[model samples]
Target chain A: MIIALTVLLTVTGFFFFFATTIGLIRFPDFYSRMHAAGKGDTLSSLLMLLGLAIYSLHHFSFGNFLVSLKIIFIMVFIFLASPTATHAIIDAGFESGVKPWTKEEERAEE
Target chain B: MHFIYMFLIMFGFWIVLSGKFDAFHITLGVISCLIVSFLSLDLFFHETKKKGRIAEVVRFLSYIPWLVKEIVLATIHVAFIALRPNVKDNIDPKVIMFKTRLKKDLSKVTFANSITLTPGTITIKVSDDEFYVHALTKKTAEGLPGEMEERVGKVFKEFGE
Candidate 1:
């Protein structure tokens, strides 16, 4: 049961990572690409970590339990850190005078 | 009181991360946590006209699940748009500038972080009460500010424009 669940979550995480890769290549602008990277990166890793944490507890030992808790701790830290990092990147883009892509500019550029 | 609470929390995290219970390691954990708590007292708690302390913290935590759900939904939305062959038609990138109702810096930062957490919307700049957001689609941008502002405001207990 645990194996099945872990495989499912790992696959889902990879699928999101795949989508992020596609978005990075296909998206028209830097901001849109950041969207893909930020959300995909955070959620995929979160799911993968959650699945790993749950699977780690399948044997039901004290050491395994502590390991699971540490995985969760990492998840929580990532939850807070990932978005802040995204905002910092966006702020950097703004500070450097990068205008966000508009419909007309999309056509005008190339 | 707050200092001790912060230290305890930090030390707990240290235990989880370090995975060691020996006397020397434990002493190092205590010393480091104490130093951190002292150095960054203001980082732990936001001092406002504190109200319904326990209730407010509970409410804010409750909002977290809803935010996670939103993040998942938005990720799926972005994923579809990214995966579809006609990606150009799918995305309408634009910057939205608006003022939020959140009063405190903590609330403002939280709101901005939440925006970035959700896919397709990245908060670019914040000044005073104003937020500049870069959104991947017009649909995502249209109905965002009002609902999110109200929700974050509830957490901070400031409920107006």
Candidate 2:
């Protein structure tokens, strides 16, 4: 059960990660790509971590549970931190005057 | 006191990991914990704050689970939106203003970070009476100073002032 679930999660995580990478490369603008990087990528990674946590419980002991809890704890920390980092990047971009793409900007010479 | 506290905490953690109460492992745990904590004293030596102490550590631990749930929910929401067929048509970006009641900087930053972690919100700038948030959806924008502010305010004891 653990092995199957781990494989499932690994596959789904890779799918989302590939989507994120593709979205970054193919999106029309920075803001759109930022949306991709900031939103789904974090969740993709967490899903992968969750599967790992469940697999870790196969050991079926207090110590394994603690290790699982520690992973969850780190997930919580990353949950708090990643978006803040994304916001910081956006804030920096805006401060440096990166404007959002208007329809006109989208059409000009593309 | 420091040595004892360190020994107790780390040894407890070691026992949790080793699943053993045997004397040999217990002694090893104590020694390891003491060494790490003693070295970590170098970190504490430069600190000057009095308000932040053991109580804050306890508070933060209590705060973790709720934050994780919020992150998961936010992540799901963002993923759904991103995968939608007509996502950009739904985008309604704007800046908003709201008041926060939290007194401490750390708690204030936590609140802001939570907003940022959510699907469509980013805290662009913050001041005492106003927080300027850049939101990607009108609905999200409308909920500024939403329940989150209240919850975070409660954590910082910023209620009803």
Candidate 3:
């Protein structure tokens, strides 16, 4: 049961990551691509880490418990850091005057 | 009090990271944590006299599960948009700006990060009371700073109008 749960979580996480890559390629511009990279990267990494933490506890030992706790700590750190990093990147883009692509821009170009 | 709290937290972190409870290792952990905490206590707890801090922390902790749920929903939303055949038809990317009522710096930071984590919206900049955000779709753009502002404000007890 635990293994099943772990597999499900990890697979779902991978699926999100794949979608993020696709979004990065297909999105019209820098800022929109950031939308995919930022959100999808964070959620997928968190899910995969959560699955790893759970799977590490399958043997039920104090050492395993500590390891899982460490994984959670890393998750918390990522939770704080990822969005801040994304904000920094987007802020840099904004500062450098990178214009965001819009529907109207596409219509005008076509 | 802040010193003690910082020291304990640092020591607890050391224990978790070190994963060793032997007397020699434990003594080393204690000494290092003491030195580090003393050096950074002010940095760690700069607002020394804030009342109801424990309660505020509890409320914030309770807020995490809801945030996690929102993150999952956000990822799925992005995935759906990305996977659709006509991605351009699905997305209407635009920059939106708004004024926020959150006064506290921590609350404003929390609100911004929360916006970035949620579906289809990413915070581009925050200057004082104003925020500039980028939204992936019109639906998401229209829902700017909605309940999230109130929730973050409640966390910091900054019920600004």
Candidate 4:
């Protein structure tokens, strides 16, 4: 049962992940694209990790618990690091003077 | 009292790494923990008040999920911006200075770090109640001091501010 739940969550997470990836491709402006990617990646990783933790509990052993703890640790680290990385990238773009998308502006740029 | 807590943490880590409960290993764990803890006494001394430190640590731990959610949202935002071929070209980067009401050093730092962690903002500098942030877009610049201030304020409360 736990395995099934895990698979379901992982699948759902991947769906969002790829959707954001596509949004990065299709969105007409930087800000809108960022809106999709930032929210999508965070949710997907979190859901996937929670699913793995749930699956780990079914085995209920010392080693398995420790492994699960390690996974949690990684998730926590990513939780901290991912935002910092994103901010850095955005800062770089801003420093370079990139302009945001607008309706009329988008039509002209394309 | 302080040594006891350090000993427990180190011993737990030792057991986790060594996967042994033998007498010799246990003895080695004690010695190693003592050595490390003794060397780290400066940290304990700096945090002289013990009554609230543990609670503060617990509070910070609980805040991790919220922090993670924020990060994930920010990442998705940036990736979408970066990958859009046509949209990627129009980024208007500008710096804005704002006044913050947060007083404590730690809270101010947390506020700055959190702002810089989000996709479109970078904390350029912070001084007491003032912060200079560089935003990738006007929207992000406008959102500054809204939700970010509230979260950082809560973190300050954790530290007994």
Candidate 5:
């Protein structure tokens, strides 16, 4: 049962990652691409790490339990860090004056 | 009091990370935690008082499940937009600015981070009470600083009512 859950979570995470990549390539501009990279990456990594953490506890040993706890700590760190990093990157782009791609701009270009 | 709490927390972290129960390693952990906590006590607590902190933490913990649900919805929303063949027609990205009433620096930072984590919106800048956010669609753009602000306010006890 636990292994089934782990596989399910990990596979779902991989699917999101694939979607993120497609979004990154297909999105029109920098800011939009960031939407994919930042949000998708955070969720996918969280799910993947959570799966690994659960799987580590499958053996039910104290050492494995500690390792699982460590994985959770890493998840917390990533959860805090990823969004901040996304904000920083987007802020830099704004400061550098990279204009966002709006629907109006696309219509005007055509 | 704060120093002791800090030391205990740091020591707990050290034990979990180091994973050693021997006296020698335990002593080393204690020594490092003491030194580190002594050096950074102010950084950790920073103007925070002892009063109501536990209640605030409890409230914050309760907030996490809702945040996680929103994150899942957000990812699915993004994925839907990304997967659609008519992606350009779907997204109407715009930069929107608004004023927030959250006064404390910590509350403001929380609100901004929450914005970045939520659906179709990312916080670009925060200056004083003003926020500049980028929204991916008209629908998401319209939903700015809505229930989220109120929820975060409750977590931080910003709302006296």
Candidate 6:
């Protein structure tokens, strides 16, 4: 049962990461690329780590449970840090006065 | 009072993290939780508004499950949009500007973080009275400073609106 759930989580995590890569390559600008990098990257990596944590509990010893708890702690930390990092990068862009990509800019790039 | 409350929570968290109930380790946890809580209890609250702290905590605790539900729904929505071919029409990224009556700094931060955590929207700028949210679609932005604001208002009990 645990193995099945672990596989499902791993696959879902990989799917998000795959989408992040596609979105990164296909998206036209830095900010849009960030949309992929920020949201997809965070969620995918979080889910993957969560899967690993669950897998770590296969034996269910107290030590393994402790290890999984630590993994969850890391997840909580990443949950807080990843979005802050994204916001900081974008805020820096806004401060540097980089104009967001507009429809006209999109056409020009093509 | 908040200092004491903070100390208890910090110690409880420390216990969970350390997972050792030995007297020496427990003593260390108590000491650390006291030092950290004393140093940073202010960080948690901009205004500890004299209302009953227990009630406030209860309200805030109830808000978490609802927020998690929203996060899941928003994630699925974004996933669907991202998976669709030719996302140009689907993703109408734009900055939405809006004003709100939420007064406390903590509530505002909660609102902003809540916005960013949900898919399809990220808070670009936050002024005392207004927000500049960068959203991935028109539908996503349409409810800004609306339903979300109301939910946060409930959480914070922002009655002065």
Top-DockQ structure, candidate number: 3
Summarize candidate 3's per-residue lDDT along B52-137 as a digit string, tens digits: 88899999999999998999999999999899999889889989899998888888899999999999999999998999999999
- Return the lDDT, model 2, position B39: 81
TM-score of the A-chain for all models: 0.92, 0.88, 0.96, 0.83, 0.96, 0.90
Residue ranges of candidate 5 with Cα displaced over 4 Å: B48-50
Candidate 2 CAPRI category: acceptable
| Residue B114 lDDT, candidate 6, scale 0-100 | 82
For residues B21-140, write the lDDT of model 2, one tens digit per residue: 889987887778788888876564354557746665676677767766875665555555556666556465566677777777777888877777666677766677567677666778
| lDDT for position A20 in model 2 | 69
Predicted candidate 6 versus true structure: per-residue lDDT over B1-161, tens digit per residue: 77887888898788778888899999999888888987897788657478567877898889888776765665566566667788775676777788878898878988887887776788777878888887777777787767777878887788753
Per-prediction share of native contacts kept: 0.86, 0.24, 0.93, 0.20, 0.75, 0.15
What RMSD, rounded to one decimal, does every model reach? 2.4, 5.0, 1.6, 5.3, 1.3, 3.2
Local distance difference test scores for all models: 0.86, 0.71, 0.92, 0.70, 0.92, 0.78
RMSD (Cα, Å) of candidate 1?
A: 2.4
Model 6: per-residue lDDT, tens digit, A1-110?
Answer: 89888999989989888877877776655666667777777778778989999999999899899889888988889877877887888778877887776565577888
Question: What residue runs in model 4 are displaced by over 4 Å at the alpha carbon?
Answer: A8-53, A80-110, B50-69, B82-85, B124-130, B158-161
Chain B TM-score for each model? Answer: 0.82, 0.64, 0.91, 0.81, 0.93, 0.78
Candidate 1 vs candidate 3, DockQ winner: 3
TM-score of each: 0.90, 0.68, 0.95, 0.67, 0.96, 0.81
Off by over 4 Å in 3: none
Cα lDDT tens digits for candidate 2, A1-110: 89899889877777677766665665455665676688667878888898898899997987788889878977777766777788788778767887765444445747
The i-RMS of every model, in angstroms, reads 1.3, 3.7, 0.8, 5.9, 0.8, 2.4
Fraction of real interface contacts that model 2 preserves: 0.24
Q: How many residue pairs clash in each candidate?
A: 0, 0, 0, 18, 0, 0
Better of 3 and 4 by TM-score: 3
Winning candidate number (TM-score): 5
Global local distance difference test of model 2: 0.71
Which 10-residue window of candidate 1 chain B scores lowest in summed lDDT? B43-52
